[model samples]
Target: MSLSLVLAALVAVTDSATHNGRAGQTTVPAVRADTTIDVDGRLDEPVWRRAALLTGFSLYQPADGRPAPDSTEVLVWYSPTAMHFGVRAYEPHGPVQATLADRDRVSADDNVEIQLDTFDEGRRAFVFIVNPLGVQADGTKSEAGGFIPGSNVMPGQNDLSADFRWQSKGRVTEWGYEVEIRIPFASLRYPVGAPQRWGLQIVRHVQHSGYEETWTPARRASASFIAQAGKLVGLAGMRHGQVVELNPELTNTAAGAAAAPSGDWRYRNDAQLGGNVRWAVGSDVVLNGTVKPDFSQVEADATQIATDQRFALFYPERRPFFVEGSDQFNVPNTLVYTRRIVRPEAAAKLTGKIGRSDVAVLSAVDDRATTSDASRPLVNIVRLRRDFGRQNTAGILYSGRTSGARATTTSPAPTRAWCSAASTSRRCRRCRA
Candidate 1:
């Protein structure tokens, strides 16, 4: 097939799932900043007056569908290259729970959370959280797939293992606290060059009162959390600058040994070249690949002492290449597990949205399996999901592996499921083949 035709096929699946503001869904207008705004935890800029204001939050925890005791006001706007938010949390008598903690480690403290489904896909959301003192913790929320047994993951929990580049500042005041956030378009992957509609939800955690409130009425009766999110519209003329990342790595090691009873000493040095590359294809799709990539983990995983457990232990994936777009590959009973491709020699992946469909294609060549070094296998995975109406999705998956003359492929029948995020664990209300 021609390259243009292939691209068209990849993106032109169907527009039936296009979102056009659900019935009774609240809408928040996103204005373009008219002046320069600083990120100093103060909404003193004149532009803030014209920015969209979100208030009248409804209680989400302790009791649902009730007015909150405290008040919170959020201002939303955007620049050509970035999105900005300013928030003022009002606390009258209760003390604020905050501390100077490391990033991605402040869930215990009182915090504010901003969830953005940039693609308007209920399957996943990018979560940005900050404490009163501006301590940051960011991650992604996967709502499409049900909870995996023995994965050490809780229901309705955000995976704090992922991090992104963003700017934030906060300060405590006598009345309450204020926070300012700026997220560059490059840090996020979204459709570019047109007006965009995204799902937005803002949450405030009142520590002393044990109150959790949301800008939208996210009642416990709701089936999906993202489905209850308000719509953010009027985001136009956005720019996702040429996002090209190249990580080049080199390592050298030397060994010395004595030869013939101290007659002579010989030394040999060995060097290896490896790197990873990522390219944003038209802001909506990303192409990632690695050549002899460094598979070393940047941080060690939390120690998991194996006890007599019914299921094997599951460790979180910390590799950058796999974690980048991992959300797209998530499905009920997760068909594609990247960690299985141990000791990868080369790998490439394509993930993002095309039209109203989420697409992911991955291929990897494993140098050896964990059980035996003599086994070299090639793995491939393809996933496609379409979203329609509110909180409804249908998808298909295909996985294959081949080694030498042996090959195996698994292509389950197309399945349709509507997932509910109301309880601690996600549940698929209906499933059909």
Candidate 2:
């Protein structure tokens, strides 16, 4: 088999509360729902009336720190197994634009967004968005310090490749529109403890009105978007038990040929088996693996109009294996780009948090086309990082590759760490071979 073998191990540590600015100060209670929430976009549930109400949204675009012309009310509450949100947006300036489009394709329409930092990490967030018609889009957002050197790929960009199990509904009202959302705890990864405090923010986009407002003061000058998020308190007894998901696929082919018209037909049949598995060891640790997987692309790459492009385009990772818990793999430098792994015969990844440290390990055998020598290069990468002093992180990266007669290693010199969207002065590392 023509393949390459790779093993990656990462260890990092950070204090979640240290980097989060104003999160503890501006707080919203996540009430425990006493009654069931019927996600019908009507907000008729009794729990909504008793749940914490979040209001006073401010303009985040065209201007900042100013009260929005229109008003939006959000209800925050939770059950033992899931978190729920109810949004009522009043838009008197213009008509709401929406469509029955596919998922992750509702940015052109008037929409509401929910940003949750499950770990209160002040950098990464899971974003759930819905249009007036209830079309949904969800993804993970990573906040890196700045752009890596020699790459057009910007950090802190959002990747909508991840899909979670959730429920939502929306309806257009006379005042504006309302959206109902329920996100299960199983679909999220948080610290393995009770009384969870998370970073929360809500955003509304008025396309026709040409305005964007957020529940908090999302200033453009802020260095970190998540750091400016409000706090979510009162999640006392929530639990996300171990979750296991298995997807099995089988392929079969049959062929027949006859040498002569009088001869009996000969038949050939072949079958192959493959699948993917995910096991949540706990709330924070997860194991993902694939065996003889049918790695197929589901979504097409976004179109880019490049009239005078000088650098290669950057396409985010969309494969299920690479996208799961991807934020844990992010570093100051783009050391391990999973897209280069092309075709993998087998792959496995492990990610979790232990104490203040984060750990991630990935092992894969890439089935790249090769020669008669049947040589598979062995590649190993290791990264170690420690974050301190509020958004300042220091990390070391080492990658080495060895084939039959070739060997190469990369050890980039460390520099300042992650760029915060909330910080004004910071620097990023320059990765080199």
Candidate 3:
């Protein structure tokens, strides 16, 4: 058969359970209910009972199906301290060679990326990628700038080992060989509570056969797990620590210069001290304040991107001078300045949940060195968020800047209003639409 014809057949076969003679025959192993754990350290419960797991349905697709000799089976589990994931792969055809590229490099061929949404909503989550050779890929949030590699916490061999287990199982009919994995808790983060719903995706790659697939149906391979992850049900009685946390920091800087009049290089060190405090008022609320904040750690622009087409990709500041829960305060189109905010000689931030509403507020004053050119402006921002449940949210935000000068002029004050919704059910109007 032509490659296109074969690929079309494979797509048809995988889309539902009828195209292939194996109609209802799923390659995924049957998961027994008894071999799982809840968030409260209880056994014999579903892994989703404590934390969320991302489903990986799009990673596997046959490249012009030709009976390629590569395949994999995956099992998932979770606990309070960590999440467990295991994959058994068959490669009788031959191993495909590959290389790693990105912030923290790892082999890209024949790998798995498990995306998890603790809230069963795509708004927030983590992405973890693991290669057949056992290389780990991770990313995180920082205060001074966009996601950078320096912030990555590489899992130690012991930590990865604690969560991963593998066993080689000879072969399976005409498909190929097989290998299995078991992942443990202590490898993930989630909120503490009961009856939680998690979004999950499991990705797999068969480089030689050029086949990739998922347990759940997926539109494409490159699609983010967040977009197509499936829902994990039956979570209740799990223990997650408070979703809010506080972090504070202090720093200093020095510089030197030379002039012709002096005919000599002069060195000088200047020390300016300041600190910022953050309080997690609740799951959706946070508060932050800073005195003499510094932006030294703020990252430089990406060398590869020459144009500023999209909104300047903003990086979370790491100076510890801004609230840690920046994502919670995201307003669609308003200017919510948290980083490089004219180095407010002093500032304060408030964020968190009140009842079912989310709120955030910030106030800061521009200092002499940073605000001398322009009239020192005191900046303030406030926002209120309302959740409609099941991943739907509506919110309003207001931002303003006032000059310290006598004229007391404020211009270009902006406000934003927006709403969004998401769901897992294929029948959900939002998902279908």
What TM-score do all the candidates reach, one by one? Answer: 0.82, 0.79, 0.55
lDDT of 1 by residue, 1-433 (tens): 8999988875653221121222233586678864556788888888787677777788899889887778888888898888998889999968888899998888788899999988887657889999988889998887787543334454467877667889999999998999999988888878655678898999899889888998888878766787678888878888786788899988778998889886698989998798899998767898999877776656766788879688566677778888787777777785666767777788999998888788999998888644343667888999899989866889998999878545435569886554554344655445421
lDDT scores in order: 0.79, 0.75, 0.47
Model 3, total clashes: 41
Q: lDDT tens digits, residues 340-416, model 2?
A: 66666677888887655677777776664532335554445554556566565666666665454354355697864
Q: Please report, as a residue range, the 10-residue window in candidate 3 with the lowest summed lDDT.
A: 155-164
lDDT of 3 by residue, 1-433 (tens): 8999999998764553211211222222212233433222112233433222222233335442122233445555444333455444555667544444442354346665555565555544555655654455543221111222222222211011112122211122233322223333223344445555676655566556556655445554432435455655555434333333334456645566786896787777767777656454433344566677566765564445437686464543454555344444455442464655746788887765555465677778876566545566777878777767645678877887766564556689784332243234234344443
Q: How far off is model 3, as Cα RMSD?
A: 19.4
Q: Which of the predicted structures, 2 or 3, would earn the higher TM-score when compared with the native?
A: 2
lDDT at position 430, candidate 2: 45
lDDT, candidate 2, at 54: 76
Model 3 ranges with Cα > 4 A deviation: 1-70, 93-110, 122-124, 133-192, 205-212, 220-228, 242-268, 275-298, 303-324, 331-363, 373-376, 389-391, 405-433
Candidate 3 global lDDT: 0.47
Question: Model 1 clash tally?
Answer: 0
